[model samples]
Target: METLETTKLDLTGKIDVVENISREDFLEFYMKPQKPVIIKHLYGKDAQVYKWTFDYFQKELGELEVGVFDDESETRQDDRSYKKAPMTMKFGEYLQIIQEKPTSKRLFLFNVFKHKKELLNHFKFPNIADNVLSFLPFAFFGGQGAETRIHRDMDNSCVFLTEIAGYKRVVLFDPKYSKLLYQYPYSTHTSIDVNHPDFDKYPGLAHVQGIDCTIGPGDTIFMPSGWWHHIEYNTAGLGFAIRSLSPHYKDRVVGILQVGLKTHIDDLANKILGSKWFDWKKNKTIERANRAIQKLQKK
Candidate 1:
């Protein structure tokens, strides 16, 4: 019998981990090349890692309401359903429900800015990321069995997401596999549900390779631009992400436009036109890809 772990094949090999590496080495090997790597010691000799706990957050921002999505990600038909009308709860209230008593309804209720600022003091600027990191960090938190759908991030930027609390399993696919994964017509999210992928419905995913990495407290994983990924919360934990501009200036400019403007416009278009628009785009995408393959084959 096949389990969730064995459902997909992992062929990218293990990601490299470097400890006490120089800035120049990082730039040459990982940053400039835009390959993923795990830096074992992002914080050098700092005892402050112990201070980033749920208890500390509760004490810091008492009674503050944060935006969260309580809906189960797996149950929702579309990824944006939760975002269409967000559910919110107080920070303290969320922490209680998230850890001791978690539900199928996923909760993403962190005070985005407030929590980010407080946690910023924990780590020094990394040479691997350098000044390329954009401001206002992103965080995701949930209990055991919680997960994110298989998808690329909205922005075409490099991401360094660090685990602060419990274990998280990040299953990654190179951007090249997007065609095989059956991506959403107008969104960055893929059509395949990581927890329960319907292989019959998504025949394109056959033989596609994935890479899995599990991170614990104080561990960070670097994800390059457009890398397709799915995240599973193995236990109740808090994770922080810092997205940096792509090394290429053109890529950075494009990312800024897409994240800041294109997403809203696309979402609005999707809403107005509905299923017809989506169906046409999906068919056209497959046709275009097939034509490209045929051209390459004849060459």
Candidate 2:
């Protein structure tokens, strides 16, 4: 971001792309080693692949009261929807807003299989994971230029995300870069926006290594567990994600406590102490990140 030479920077423009990769190769090269890879031509000639358009989504979820990410209310109005107090709207109405133009809100239909099991007939999931979580079949809809915050799944689950429509670019950093990411204590997300980070404030990130991948419809990305990722929807992108646990389960259990229980505690603290709880946590995180950067420079 500071106009440094590309060679000197830790991020590279390339990602491992394979077409119709064998299961053996996936396990040996990417899965076992915990590296990210993109598989091209993974599927074809499927009704779901072609039929999962914006129009189709509207019809299927139309009458349902769906949860929406209210960007302004999340910060300005101090409204916390869907941790317990969710903001609900008609799916058809939200579709209209996104179709018109880009908007602050995002449409996140989590675990659709729970509500409408009939919708599963439209698509097929790949047989890759040893174990896939049942309730985490995520469907995300974002407006043009919308970005998800840089975060790790507190469950420590590996991910296989496929593009259903439009295009998206993902920026990923390995778990080792967590200290450089300005992550709050016991939280799953980083505060700095990866696409347009304030380098002066988060200088440790300058030395962070990351992978950038642009995937279109039908392409799937294998995101290793604990990786930090920020996704940008280049167009009005619709995507689905399936998450799996590592063969080793002990660490993931620890992650659930750190992120799941800790996050609930933080929210409860905020409810009692107000903004001071968040302000103090954010300030402490910044202090830690700044110190790490200074230490890196000294070395």
Model 2: how far residue 121 lies from native, Å: 3.0
Candidate 1 Cα lDDT to native: 0.68
Instruction: Compose the digit string of candidate 1's lDDT tens values, residues 81-199.
Output: 24532566777877777778655434442335564475666666566556565455766777777777676776678888878888888888877766667666546765577656665
Model 2 TM-score (2 dp): 0.85
Question: Which candidate tops lDDT?
Answer: 2
**Per-residue lDDT value at 169 in model 1:** 88
Steric clash pairs (candidate 1): none
Model 2 residue runs over 4 Å out of place are 1-10, 41-47, 76-86, 294-299
What CA RMSD would you report for each candidate? 3.9, 3.5
